[model samples]
Target: MIEIVARNGSPEAMLCPAFICDACRKQVMEAGNVIYAVRYPDQSERETSPLFVAHKGACDMAVQQWLAANYPVADGWSDLWDEIDDFLAYLGGNFKRSFAEDADGQYVPHVVVMPATSPKLP
Candidate 1:
C-alpha cells in the first residue's frame, strides 16, 4: 500500500519549516503544490515509511516513473499512482478556492494517510 500526504505549517507561526522536494531537490514553498508521503507495502508504519515529497508537475511525474521502474506493477502500483493524481487534483482545486475566499489565510500542515492492508506474515 502507498500513502500520500500534503503538509504545511500554521499561519500563526513565526516561521515554517522548509520542505524540500525529494525529486527536484528544491524547496516546497507553496500550500497549493502537491506533496506526497509514500508508504510501500514493506513499510510497517508511516513514521518508518520512506517519504517521497515532490511538486505536482514534472517532479511528480518523475517520481511516478521511478516508482514504476523500481517496484512491481502487480502490487497495486497503478492504483497508488492514480490515487496520487487524484489527490493532486483535489489539492489544486482546494487551493484555488481557498485563495479566492481568503488570500491572506495561512495554510496549516495536514496529513492524510492511506488505509493500510493486512500485514504480511513472516
Candidate 2:
C-alpha cells in the first residue's frame, strides 16, 4: 500500500520509510477510523494481508474489503461483509489514496476542495 501524509487531512506522499507502518495507519481520533484508499505505484494489485488484522470488530471489516478486491464483481458488490459496517463510520474521516483499483475497478475516490488556508490560494 502507498502511504501518504495528509496536509490538513488531504493526502501527500511519505517522505521516507522512517515512519512506522502504524504511522501510515492514521487514527480517526474524532472521525473514529479513517477509511481511505492508498495505492502503491510499484506494488501489484493484491488484497490486504490477513495477518495484519486488528480491532477485529473493525479489522474484520478491513479483512472483508481486502477479500472483495481479491475477488471482484463487475456489476457491483455481491457481498457486504458484516465488518464493513464497522468501518463505514470512518470512511471519510481519514483516508489514504492510491492509483490502484478498488472493488469498483478504479483508482480510489478523490476530489479537490475550495482551498481552506491559502494566500489567494488555488
Best by TM-score: 1
In terms of lDDT, the poorest run of 10 residues in model 1 is 113-122
The sequence of per-residue lDDT tens digits that candidate 1 reaches over residues 12-78 is: 4354355455566667555313333343444442212234556667776766555444443565343
Q: What is the Å distance of residue 102 in model 1 from its true position?
A: 34
C-alpha lDDT of residue 90 in model 1: 77
TM-score of each: 0.37, 0.19
Give the poorly placed runs of model 1, Cα more than 4 Å off: 1-16, 31-49, 76-122
Q: Estimate the overall C-alpha local distance difference test score of candidate 2.
A: 0.33
TM-score of 2: 0.19
**Which lDDT tens digits does candidate 2 get at residues 12-108?**
5444321112222533232222223222223454222211212334443654465346433552324332222355444444366333634555553
Per-model lDDT: 0.47, 0.33
- For residue 99, model 1's alpha carbon misses the true position, in angstroms, by 33
